[model samples]
Target: MTEPRWLDTEEMAAWNAFVEASNLVARRVEQQLREQAGLSHPQYEILVRLAAEPDGEMRMTELAQRVVTSKSGLTYQVTQLEKAGLVRRRNCDTDDRGVIAGLTDAGREKLREAAPGHVELVRANLIDVLSRDQLRVIAAGLGAVTRALRERP
Candidate 1:
């Protein structure tokens, strides 16, 4: 049997730091969203993506892909948002089997209200902590990783 390679000390330190930072950042963002907007981080992400669309609308499948959630998970979130009057589901015009989720005016307002605090939290936790060059390098490295993952079968 081939022996598994383990991370060296320096690599282990980097990996641990990455995991810790990621967890902390996610928790902070989630807390801020829940406290200030009564929204979970995932829901906030959905709102942000829909708001960016030309008509504040997107297919459920597309949204699932963008948010990196399963179709069932997106459906649940969308259903919750719908009950809160933040979003509505519509039949896709060209495909009877497709579902589209569109942000309501209330949803847009909620997003507008939540945006400032969210941006501030992100800056406080992440952006402001890094130099411009460091940010650029991190972005490039993460972007490469994201692309690779998405391209995998």
Candidate 2:
């Protein structure tokens, strides 16, 4: 096997900082969502995605893809949301084997209640920490990485 090239000091520092910041931000957001909204980060994301859809619904598999979650994970989250009367699962009209998840009115209400705290947490922990140019650079860098990963076989 070929010897692996290790990260240099600058690269190592950058990677470590990125990982640390990402973890801290996620934890803070999760805490705020759980405490104020009784929702997990993933649950909050699911609600947001559904809210953005034209019909406020999406196929389960599509939702999983958009959320970067496993099919089973999405199913479990949907089940939990259904239990809370925040979401419902329906049979897909055109596909017998497919299921769609639709956001309920209760879900929209919860999202509306949760959004302010969530946005504040995000701004305080992340967006407000960076300058506009830094934010742009960070977004471009992360987007490039995302595209590269998605393009990989």
Whose TM-score is greatest here? 2
Please report, as a residue range, the 10-residue window in candidate 1 with the lowest summed lDDT.
10-19
* C-alpha lDDT score of every prediction, in listed order: 0.97, 0.96
- Per model, how many backbone clashes are there? 0, 0
25 Cα displacement, candidate 2 (Å): 0.5
Error of 1 at 30 (Å): 0.4
> Alpha-carbon error at 6 in model 2, in Å?
0.9
lDDT of 1 by residue, 1-153 (tens): 998899999989979988999999999999999999999999999999999999999999999999999999999999999999999999999999999999999999999999999999999999999999999998998899899999998
- Candidate 2 residues 20-115, lDDT tens each? 999999999999899999999999999999999998999999999899899999999989999999999999999999999999999999999999
Q: lDDT for model 2, please.
A: 0.96
* Model 1 quality (TM-score): 0.96
Per-prediction TM-score, please? 0.96, 0.98
- Cα lDDT for residue 143, candidate 2: 99
Q: After best superposition, candidate 2 residue 144: deviation in angstroms?
A: 0.8
Pairs that collide, model 1: none
